[model samples]
Target: MSSVANWSCTATATIWRSLGKDETGDPLGYTEPEQILCDYEGGLSKKLASLGAEIVVKNTVWTEFALAATGDYLLIGSSTEPDPVVAGADEVRQVIRYGDTFERVADDYAILTGI
Candidate 1:
């Protein structure tokens, strides 16, 4: 299959990557990582918004950082998050799902749906 062209990774997203489970079994995460620039959409349809999809991020299959995960939280800016785990009232999108569509056609894309 032929490789598809890269998507417009123009949006700079500041992310707090999930560091897996901690010793106390609490969710642990930090912001030593930022996702490579990708397509980030802030708005969604009413139906989608009702379904908890507050924001959408479309990233390329190839990236410099790790793929998006369920526990990861992100803010669509260049600012860093000191403690996303303890982030209080800050409006950030938490990645709920990650999917990769690969094909010979122009459908190769990695998508991260956040809420």
Candidate 2:
């Protein structure tokens, strides 16, 4: 048997999801702040578009969260706080589940895009 170390960073941020617009065409809101263990990182790159526009590609800020023994609260399209208490800060992005098959050992990751 092997033991894995727990995450050293803590992230506290609001999780947001679009609940569709109201009759007046205004967007509704639903969010909740939660603290969880995670790791964060960011990078940047530059690329030229076909239209001769200089496009700056900020590397996706990846946030990895260890899976609980019970495997709960993991969903794609869910956004989390990119700034973990341990270090680094970035904008919120959609969640990316990191695995091909169903397993509790793998971690859940959030892909932060520069918008």
Candidate 3:
């Protein structure tokens, strides 16, 4: 099946992932997630990008990929964009979990697990 970006990403969410501060009170850096990162029901994973320091993640919503209407799997790096990314399966733009409530840790990134 082919990927589609037919849906408009009209919604936006602001999540506060706890970041550790240095002695000067600056962010040490973003944390990484353990287990599987999910968006809605979609399990998102990280992939390397051509752009320097940029990363991509899956935008899938179904456990079974074939079940999804279209593959829009996409972005994670402090993204200000409102919607998910639509790219190749081997490639992806990560997403944030709207329903997820993460257990903040010192060195841990935000894990998007939902009920």
Candidate 4:
């Protein structure tokens, strides 16, 4: 009967709906996930800062070729630093599919389905 409970129920319903069939006969799913790039020149950190976002630098992993083309998505959290313009840290996730372009797939979720 609390907000959390309500949110959970809502989320569950949404999930079911997303998984279920729609009137248009299209399946619901997430597009391809892309890796979050961070710790590099002109990376997500700088972008977020430019956007007036205060983020805490979290885990950083070093990857090599054959899988390093895409950088890791920087996991950032709300900043505790004092800054009026800076907003809370937002979570970012990184993912790469074996095949298929995340962009094209995103443009058409009915074409591809996976979170």
* Model with the higher lDDT, candidate 1 or 2: 1
TM per model?
A: 0.49, 0.40, 0.18, 0.19
The residue ranges of model 2 lying beyond 4 angstroms of the native Cα positions read 1-5, 8-14, 22-26, 45-94, 100-103
Give the candidates in order of lDDT, highest first: 1, 2, 3, 4
* Position 26, candidate 3: lDDT: 63
The stretch of ten residues in a row with the least summed lDDT in candidate 3 is 62-71
Candidate 3, superposed: residue stretches over 4 Å from native: 1-6, 21-111
Cα lDDT of model 1 by residue, 1-115, tens digit? 2232354555666666667778898866554746455555544423245667544433222222345555666555565547654442123333333333455343323434333
- Please report the candidate that would top lDDT against the real structure: 1
For model 3, residues 6-77, the per-residue Cα lDDT tens digits are: 122223222223245689976443323211222232454555545665443333331111211112222322
lDDT of 1: 0.47
Global lDDT of each model? Answer: 0.47, 0.38, 0.28, 0.24
Considering every candidate listed, which one attains the maximal TM-score? 1
- In TM-score terms, candidate 1 sits at 0.49
Cα lDDT tens digits for candidate 4, 1-115: 3232223222110001123336896544322332321221113332234568654433222211122211211213322333212322222222223322332321111111111
Error of 1 at 35 (Å): 4.7
